[model samples]
Target: MTGPSPETASRPACWRPARADDLPAISAVLTDPAFFDVLGAVTPEALAEACAPDGARRLLAFDIDGSLAAFAYLSGCDGDRPKLEEFAVLTRGRGTGTRALSALLEVLRAEGRASFWLHVVPDNSRALALYRRLGFGREEVLPDFWQTRNGDRVDLLRLHYDFVPAGV
Candidate 1:
């Protein structure tokens, strides 16, 4: 995808490799009440470890005007089909999340990855809509796929985004 348009230039959001120091902000976004139902529980320590360079996961933080606006967590980074484990945006309806996802896809394309996937709670219509808009297709619905902090099971919808190599 192309870069953000001039209209979004005023509040430019950029994506960068997440650092250990960003753990608190990542945790706050993950555990925010607005996303609690979709994200469940996430601790800062866990986020820090996951974002570590040697870990199986990689995290990209979206910054706007020097503050964390959102984050994307990818697992199985060493493999061909990495999974987007978490994508949370603290500042919603501002297009930050879309920009973050686009930046991530560019990174993955540069790394020669063919596709990636993510699982979302069935009730998260907003996220689902965004994913669809970004060319992600619904793969399947896995019943009782995610367990909440309260021990409740939630159905998950799997979405996949395949990268068609340029000119292919």
Candidate 2:
């Protein structure tokens, strides 16, 4: 990993909109063995789309001491529904994903988002617990929701976080 582990690094105050230059490290993390199931395919083309001023796909990165440590991948924010496709840490167990993801969530809230959704592999118990602890409600099981690069079907647990509850 290019950056310090979560426990050793100073906690970042916030996340920033991902820039073109962040692509390399962001690519490295997403493609790393620890997170590839989400997507090892966050290509340059995709990064371009994410960095575009009006594109739907958005990338938010949190760095420590100028190196990439974590990033959140989101899409369709301008519409009624936004999906948090990935909120990944460069390493698997440094334990900073919660902090980074919390900061990233604020970025979305600042944009006037009322709610957003994410999906995680059912088997990733740690991630599931983390999201739940952060107040994401488990919505349902989306069976065979995705097909991996290896042509394997993966079922995901859909989760939702509402900044403003519906009945409020």
Candidate 3:
């Protein structure tokens, strides 16, 4: 759905940078079967390094009712164009991802970025629908872009969103 359900729409959004200690919780949410297929067998140590407090990347989390609801990882953050590396939402079909992503786009806009980009598996129509609804456009296809833990290579469709500052 493009819009969050009314109940979820009113819920508060708690987006914060993920600390080193948050890796376990983050790893749990991501390794669940709901997400494990796409994420593969990610380890906590790997998460710690990827989500390190260093300025090179931005790993943000979204919480609801004091519980982890979503996680977003951005790379190439030291540059003008940050790449949205990963987006995982524990709560789906509740408009959680949409709202969470909208919040992230605003953050990028506030950062004065001209644009941000992400890659999604072509088969993830649900995510593709959401991306398109949120103003992302297809850029190109990167063949064999993702290598899963099972030795399977996956192609990804690159999508990008250009920032539109408030009031145009």
Candidate 4:
């Protein structure tokens, strides 16, 4: 709901709503072969349009040094179930992805969202492990869920994280 607390001040990265100007950087992250292979092709123009305030909600994680490290895009926020359209960390093994995801969840919980879900290519074992570690449960697998730029159809695993209201 609000910015990071004092305790998180020392954290290496912080998450904030992505702005129009961040589209290029976000596109760069999305264009990474590692991310593209898992997700799909995304041009700067397309990313800019998708992340527009009127479209999807985009969050970016910037390092203490003000460098863009990761980003997450959420679609269908107006509905009860928001879907994580894309999530990627430019710098791997630095906990950027985990931190970004944690921040997003905190914001979602504060907003009283019931649940959130994401579709990950089944072959993205690293991402799947991280999602599981973050308490996301594998729901189902959709065959040929995504067709890549190369025309390869990939199966995707749907994962979800349900929020339990406090004092329940």
Candidate 5:
């Protein structure tokens, strides 16, 4: 049930490469009840695999002190800009979300990734807002894109984010 302290001010922060050892701590934040309510349950083993050394994808973030205040996952990039598959924050009403997204964008930009794509559960209003604020837009809505816990499929909103500067 441990969570990040409330954010009192909005400030700039940077991100760095994440290691396999960070997986357990990162998984703890991701598996929190508050987060599970939206993304559903995910196993730590899955996270570890995603963060494995040989994986083409990567997970990165900015931690406040020793706590993972924010986190994100980039995948499917290969030779292109990787898509941000997931982003999360441990606190609400704070700028942690924005900072995290910004950091992730910077990393993608540095890697020459001009654009990426992802999908969101249409019902997650908060996540929708966050993605929009981070410059993601709805590209399409896939009906029955994701199966739910109750054996019912729900729609998903496909979103795209372009980080390339104008005329680039």
Candidate 6:
């Protein structure tokens, strides 16, 4: 799907690798109320660890204003594909998630990754729709996949996408 265009309505966010100096901004974005509601509790240390690219890690997203927009991290899976462990954006209704996702696909393409997969709470309709728009398809749904911060268990929907180069 085509990404948000650079227009007056909303400037598309800039994409880059996570920097050591961006830890504070990234932490705030990840631990925001919106994030907590969807992703449950997130610790600062965990965010820092993910930001540090030791292996097949993530590339962080920053907005045009230089604010931390989102992050996408992956780890080795059973085969050549990588499992998208975490992907979250700070703001909504501005296509920040779309921008971040497009950037992620580019990075994966650069690395020649065959596929990327992730799991999300089934009830997160916004995220589900976004993933669908980005070419991800539901592989399975696991019951009682995780517990929320409020101690409520929830189901998880696993999604996968096989990347195909243009003109292939």
The lDDT for every candidate, in the order shown, is 0.79, 0.77, 0.78, 0.74, 0.69, 0.71
For 1-168, candidate 5 gives per-residue lDDT tens digits of 865445623333656556676777677776665554356444666566566433666667577655567667767757565666667776767888877777677767787776877878878898888889888874798987787554567888889887765487
Comparing 3 with 4 on lDDT, the higher-scoring candidate is 3
State each model's C-alpha RMSD to the native: 5.4, 4.0, 5.5, 5.6, 4.9, 5.8
lDDT of 2 by residue, 70-150 (tens): 888888867756898777787667767887878766766787888889988887788888999889994799999887655
Report the number of clashing residue pairs per model: 0, 0, 0, 0, 0, 0
Per-residue error for 56 in candidate 4, Å, reads 4.5
The weakest ten consecutive residues by lDDT in model 5 span: 3-12
**Model 1 reaches what TM-score against the true structure?**
0.82
Q: In model 2, what are the clashing residue pairs, if there are any?
A: none
Q: Can you tell me which runs of candidate 4 are displaced by over 4 Å?
A: 1-12, 50-65, 165-168
Error of 3 at 156 (Å): 1.0
* lDDT for each residue of candidate 6 in 1-168, tens digit (9 for 90 to 100): 765455622755566667777777666665666555466555666556556555554545555555677766566723558887767776668898887887777777787778888888878899899999999984698999888665778888899888864357
**Once model 2 is optimally superposed onto the true structure by TM-score, how far is the C-alpha of residue 122 displaced, in angstroms?**
0.4
- Poorest 10 consecutive residues by lDDT, candidate 3: 34-43
What global local distance difference test value does model 3 have? 0.78
User: What TM-score does prediction 2 earn?
Assistant: 0.83
| lDDT tens per residue, model 1, 1-168 | 786556665665677778887887787777666666787565566677676654678777888766777888888888877999889887789887787788778878788887889998878898888898888884699998888655679999999988874467
Q: Which stretches of candidate 1 lie over 4 Å from their true place?
A: 1-12, 165-168
User: What's model 4's TM-score?
Assistant: 0.79
Instruction: Name the best candidate (by lDDT).
Output: 1
By summed lDDT, which 10 consecutive residues of candidate 2 come out lowest? 33-42
